[model samples]
Target: MTSGAPSDWYRWIPEQISARDYELLPEDFCRTIEVVDGHIVKCESPSRLHNRVARRIATHMEAGRKPEPCLMVDTDVDVRISDVPLSLRRPDVIVYRCLDDDAKLYAGDTVLVVEVVSPDSSFHTDTVEKKAAYAAAGIPVYLIVFLTEAADGIELIEEYRLSEGRYHLVCLHTRRLTVDSPIPVDIAFGDLASG
Candidate 1:
């Protein structure tokens, strides 16, 4: 995990296995899996609340985008953390400049990436490591919607922007998030937990 590799969780799975190989595995009963640093990392299934929040944020973003430059889906893509690293990550949501239908979207084309902290999962992976990875890949904006163990359900939303090959905190809010870079966005965290 120091330089190029992560934890040895999948140490026995072999180092040369590709993403295709991970896909061919006989199905994981519970977890969502991805190949990171040539290791198969299993992510815990997101709780219904977690998914609901993510969906609301996505919906809100779609509703709030404006007319200057049409921010399209740019196609859902598996982003490589870096050109040399073998990380293929699927962010919860991503948006960028609208391009041809057939164009393949890469990290360089990303304008924003959102990650919602899952209630049933360890939120560690979404913090520094993934944010660093995304920043390292030159993605402009990164947002993390925190859904922690709090009485109100939604905890806080943290926004980070890439600056000088690294990410720096722009703002943190508990009720709402408004971002104006890479594409404007206004989201209400309270709406996410409401039925």
Candidate 2:
């Protein structure tokens, strides 16, 4: 009937909403939501500073890499994992291999997903649950850049790499540091912490 399925059309009305029913979102909606296991989770909105940092990261990655073969979508891009039928999640940024003549709705084989952690997102969901979920989906790198200005001042940069079905903390940089990775890049801690 609308962007969502017939069931999700009425917000206040009581009806069973499944994953399949959750994908029917209005095309013009400004915000993007992730339907995980029938629960609607709002994605973290990018602050101006967050957007700046994200843009820098994507730009650097794109410029430095030769034959750049990945698609970088902003926070509004959705990546659906087949694990749950109705689960449609929009990462702050996602990088996936450029498919040849593949015009699929969702890019599930995303190699990297970056989340600029925000106050609106559930800590456990982003730092823990989503970590595991990405690993299960074969997402190689899950980068988290913290914006909270503490003693480190955006120094808490986490690089979790998936290996053998588990995500192990590979590097935790508390200062402006370079990460030697399959992605290959340096992150300015100040850029992330700055207003």
Q: Identify the leading candidate in terms of lDDT.
A: 1
lDDT of 2: 0.63
| Candidate 1 structure quality by residue, lDDT tens digits, 130-171 | 887788789988888888666446889888888999889989
Clashing residue pairs in candidate 2 are 3-24, 3-25, 3-26, 4-24, 19-86
Worst 10 residues of 2 by lDDT: 12-21
Q: Compute the lDDT for candidate 1.
A: 0.69
Q: Give the TM-score of candidate 2.
A: 0.77
Instruction: List, residue by residue over 71-180, the lDDT tens digit for candidate 2.
Output: 54444466776534455566666777665434543545677787766645556677887787788777888888776747334647688888998889988877764655
lDDT on C-alpha atoms for all candidate structures: 0.69, 0.63
| Prediction RMSDs, each to the true structure | 6.6, 3.7
